[model samples]
Target: MIKEVGIIGLGNVGKVLATFLKANGMLYWAVSRSAADDENILRNISDIKELPSLIIIAVADKYISAVSEKLAHKFGKELEGVFVFHLSGALSRNELILCENNGAIIASAHPFQTFFVTGNYENVFVDVLEGISWGIDCKAEYFPEIEKFINKLLGKAKYLSSETLAKKAIYHASAVAVSNYLTAAITLAKKMANLADIEAEDFLLPIIKTTIKNNFSDVDFPITGPIARCDLAVVKEHLENLSVKPHLQKSYAFFGAALLELIKDEKIMSEEQIKQLEAILLQKHLY
Candidate 1:
């Protein structure tokens, strides 16, 4: 039933939220620290003459607390009945406790999707959010509103208990491993491909896509590679080739060792093979 909304930041997430809210016919206001040519985006929170029922603090994690405090001060007791939420994967509802102390209902709703928009954002359609999951940490009573909000944006809401939200650091770390770390690994592969005088995308894209698709299709065990096959000779040759680039060498060795640990319980490799692969991956010379 909540129709009016406000956004406290105009970063990539904020802009996308604003666009989707407008597209969905929700009455809203948005503000940023700096001035902008967009009339819908106000210069400051104080610029608004009317307050909305819900306010999303879409600023970076570092600024969530400060921004919440500012809101607590700016609206004072008027925030008593308003709902305040932040879009930080690593932070919990505690980040907005100041606003809560001042009587605002607070929660943390993090969309499990990355936003790296540059230049014009007009072309960044809302369909990108379709079917994406949102990690929501809030009181059970407030879930319906949050779920409705996400549904409007074509996303699904996943509720997290207070205990689960408290361990958000680990949860966010998992996200970073799959997204950021995966990107780093791909970059390293591109560099390795360069050494072979081949374009990384042309050589790796198909296999990478297929691998990811297979993994998603069967998450329990979809691993494939020289390590998965327990191909000791191939692993040794890779380490030797990477010896010229110590950084890449270390990265490969570390990940190779991790992958070995992951498949140690599987029947794919014999106990002796596992130990041998581990030794090669963990050898001091590789480091």
Candidate 2:
């Protein structure tokens, strides 16, 4: 039933959301300091108080609190039934107190997708990543209408209770770690490929695509690298090479420990082999 929307913060996330909303035939008003960049959205309002029925704040986390408060104060009287939602992955609905206090229905609708600055949209997210959405810290009865609307209109949205938003935070973080951190790891792999006298991109095609393919079907253990084979010698050599990049070394060791633990559950790695990797990981201060 919520048709008209006002979207703030026209960054990557905001821009993508706007594109989807417009293509879906929703009457939308997008706002930003550089609103002139895109002249084709439904409408670009300069004032937050003049926002439509639904105000989607896609601003930075630091700005979400202050900006939501200012908007609430400005539209306190007029927000009788308007819905004000933010697109933050980490913030809960309690942070949206300003809107809730002003009688505006508030929640968080986070689409689990990446932003490609390049111009392309088809199959960008597909089944490789899923959308996980949750609401603010408020009673379900207070915003059941919005919850139902989200389920009907948006991507596969799952409801998390207000009090359970913290648990939902972990869920959201895991999604980001899988998507964002995977990209970082691949970038490192490409760099290592270049350093090893192989064309970085030449050998990346199947491995990259196949990894995504595997993830789409199931959560299979990574089977290519040393960790997959529990190759202690190769893993130790990797640790020695990674000593120069201390932060990356720690990250690799920490995640490697978790992955090592996972594979051992399936009896892929013996207890002795798992401890061997854990010992190397501890040397990197990642215990």
Clashing pairs in 2: 93-136, 93-137
Give the Cα-based TM-score of candidate 2 against the true structure. Answer: 0.75
Instruction: State the displacement of the C-alpha of residue 135, model 1, in Å, after optimal TM-score superposition.
Output: 1.3
Off by over 4 Å in 2: 23-27, 34-49, 120-154, 161-164, 215-225, 237-258, 261-268, 281-287
Every model: Cα RMSD to truth = 2.4, 4.4
Question: How many times do residue backbones clash in model 1?
Answer: 0
Record all residue pairs in model 1 with backbone atoms less than 3 Å apart, i.e. clashing.
Answer: none
Worst 10 residues of 1 by lDDT: 119-128
Q: Could you give me the TM-score of model 1 versus the true structure?
A: 0.89
Deviation from native of the Cα of residue 211 in model 1, angstroms: 1.1
lDDT of 1 by residue, 129-223 (tens): 77888999888998998899878778999999767777889989988888887888888888889887998889989988987898889477898
